[model samples]
Target chain A: MQPDPRPFDEPWQAQAFGLVVHLHERGLFSWTEWAGTLSNVIAAEQSDTPTNAEYYRCWLTALEQILAQKKIATPDLIDITTQAWHRAAHATPHGQPIMLESDPKRIEVK
Target chain B: MHDHPHDHDNNLDPMTARVRALETILTDKGLVDPKAIDAIVDTYETKIGPRNGAKVIAKAWTNPDYADWLAKDATAAIADLGFTGRQGEHMQAVFNTPDQHNVVVCTLCSCYPWSVLGLPPVWYKSPPYRSRVVLEPRAVLAEFGLTLPETTKIRVWDSTAEVRYLVIPMRPEGTENMDESALVDLVTRDAMIGTGLPQVAS
Candidate 1:
């Protein structure tokens, strides 16, 4: 389903925003063009109610198009990212405790 | 556009329905080109994946001084390996200790450290994981079959701005003497996500 819109408003939201900006600045897509497309997609989805996956797919699609248009990254990059996305969706086992694998030689900073 | 039985409003399963609806809109609007998406995914898989991160992990395991350098400046350290851009240019590694287990979640959107870990998992970008992981990290970890010790302090890292984070999991027990490749085997995808510990084959 639709993600809680709250997180998208946080300061941390800028990370993704900045990523979009970087891609745009790199000539992938103009800010106006990207924003117009994204806003239109979001608005359309909002009219009918959207799922989380649907929204993400939309976002990823936008990213992919922009990257392709700019030729910032080759088609291969998109394939790899999508494959990882699919593999993780299916292969990530449920209900397991996760541990961080530290570099043994690295000192832990408090 | 075309009326599909699985429209967002009509679907019972919110997740599936939403994805379908969004896909329809994206396609209809020409916002997302599938061929392009596939291409981007392919690039990351072939050119930069966990192997790059593994190299960093391996070096840290074998070289004490290098590990020290990595902990201090993961970005520059990773750059030394010729892996830079997209996500890894500005990197930070959070170490997981016996008393402290660290996990990372973007919280906002899927702001992953692609430079090191390559592209993020689909779940990482999913609303369920992004929304819930920060709010209920322990429960999320439980889903991954990762249980922390009661005494262990749980720290959730939020990747923000220019800095991206990679979880440095503790070396599994009985693998102190093992070589790098053996150690890499223990460093699973979960370890990067801070959900599961790396296991060494006894």
Candidate 2:
């Protein structure tokens, strides 16, 4: 559960791992605790069978929640990260058109 | 991180202004604390860096057996290379074949195989990528300079729960004799995303 110091060997991996370490050092969930919680969440979501994507999403959601709960990241930081994500999305030339405004209230119920 | 005077300028872009507005609302609602922003930035800079992905790709290109192992059991395979846990413990790599083009997206949110590919790129987590990739994969891939034949089946992999996917694009033609390091150089971040294939420089 303690984030393996060697989990990431590449520079990028180390950098990413460093972010988590920073969060933990800042009083966010310890690496072990975070890994345990994430594993448990993934396990609970699994049925007799589970898809890879489902498992991926579960872990991601858990990571996001843990960060949010500890206040390790501000909404602004999340926004900036997500915005970068948006730019990558746009970089891809071919993909289905996705409607950003999904809330029923945001759409006129004609 | 260097200080940005431009960030403090009052004439904010529409997106920045909207973000500021949202921040104010969230702050007023006691949803987000102010100190958290600094912590977040610190984490991104000092903790989760981009080197993770680079390493995975480098290894994959260098070691065919390792690449095959990664395609089969990305988590354990990566761990064998001493890259496990943290953001990459649970991972998968989908192969992009001649007849089938694979693309990855996180529809609900920006779910990524961070352990292997490092952190998800900023755009991979964006609404446009998530919403559009599933619905319009060909158009998206096209933007990335990938034009698949109509007969080529486009399989969009959605990274959701504990399993995240990285694309293993077919090594380009005419680079059979290249050494691993040379091969690694051809695997770009975009190629791993399935937007482009690795091409040996002329």
The iRMS of the candidates, in order, is 15.4, 13.9
State each model's CA lDDT, in order. 0.59, 0.58
lDDT per residue for candidate 2 within B1-202, as digits (tens), equals: 6455543212333333333433434445555554665455444445643345545666776688888898888888767756565433367878777799888886654556655554565456555666678999999888777888999999998776556777877777887787766666667667777877765677
Model 1, residue A1: distance off in Å is 33
lDDT of 1 by residue, B59-166 (tens): 788788878988998888878988776522378888888888988886555567767676566566565776677788888999999888779988888765456788
* Model 1: CA > 4 A from native: A1-25, A28-56, A60-110, B1-41, B87-89
Q: Residue A86 error for model 1, in Å? A: 27
**Judged by lDDT, which candidate is best?**
1
For DockQ, the strongest prediction is 2
Model 1 per-residue lDDT at B201? 59
Residues A18-81, candidate 2: write the lDDT tens digits: 3344455555566456666665665456443433344444544565667567665566666664
Docking level of model 2: incorrect
Give the alpha carbon lDDT tens digit for every residue of A24-57 in model 1.
4445555446645664454444323344445554
Error at B79, model 2, angstroms: 1.7
User: Can you tell me the CAPRI class of model 1?
Assistant: incorrect
